[model samples]
Target: MIGLLSTTFGVSVASALLPLISVELFAIGLVLKEPEIPWWVLALVIATGQIGGKLLHYYAARGAIRLPRFLRREKSGKSSPGRWRAWLESFRENCRNRPVWAGSVLLISAVASLPPFAAVAVIAGWAKVPVSTFLITGFIGRFARFGVLAAAPAAMATWL
Candidate 1:
């Protein structure tokens, strides 16, 4: 659990630094003038960072708040555990016992993948998703995203 939290913190920081990292990698000649990081490395980095963030989100949600706490920065502060719990309560009537929780977790993760609301990591944490599952899913999703980013320029360069 502690490891997951730390990993997530590292991942979040990495995501925040992605633009600068790209430039540095380019300048360092790790990424050539062709203007793309290698697909495998890009996928690995994205997966590591995103999964780490998601794990951190889960731990944060699971950690009950205490008074007079000092945090480095505020959380994403969008939909929190409180909000999610309330929503679950209201929807409990129509929800079955088994599928509801897991389904909601996956659904939230999938939804978070969309733009302007990248909350998969946070949502997965709030939903108490298994760390293994979160990491696996995150890896797959991040790989797909990075693969697209890496491929775009190469594909277009072929035409040019």
Candidate 2:
């Protein structure tokens, strides 16, 4: 049981890191095949793994993880910042001023995947949302999402 849960956690982290992987599909399939594993246990494991994985992007965006030279933009030799930089700065500043709004958006994105949770995770970190807030909010949102998905197979079985 420990080994299975550990594998699920690792898979969840990988899914979080790799865009091509779908942890939702994985949780559903796991539950369908191994109904003996408690749904809440799966949800907790997946949620922790997901948040742990997303921390990479969060730290990278926050400038803690140094991006490679190729990923970094070259200076344009212009005195003024580019329009995109200006916009990002503005957005970041707005988020700093309205942390609750930013956190709410992050919560919404994590749960709904609207506006893309990956983008939001990077943005949230770049915007300087508190680390505690980020982790707590992300965990809650992801837990809710995976909890439903993990339980879905059993729910359908009961219904059908």
Find the candidate with the highest TM-score and give its number.
2
Q: What's the TM-score of every candidate structure?
A: 0.55, 0.90
Q: Model 2 compared with the native: what TM-score?
A: 0.90
Give the local distance difference test score of model 2.
0.87
Error of 1 at 75 (Å): 16
Q: Which stretches of candidate 2 lie over 4 Å from their true place?
A: 78-87
Residue-level lDDT tens digits of model 2 in 1-160: 8988898999989988897898888888889889999889999999999999999889988999999999886867888898988988988997889978877887888888887888888888888888988998889899988888888888999999
Clashing pairs in 1: 8-52, 58-125
Query: What is every candidate's alpha-carbon RMSD to the true fold?
Result: 8.3, 1.7
Model 1 misplaced regions, further than 4 Å: 1-13, 16-37, 64-85, 88-112, 115-118
Q: Which candidate number has the best lDDT?
A: 2
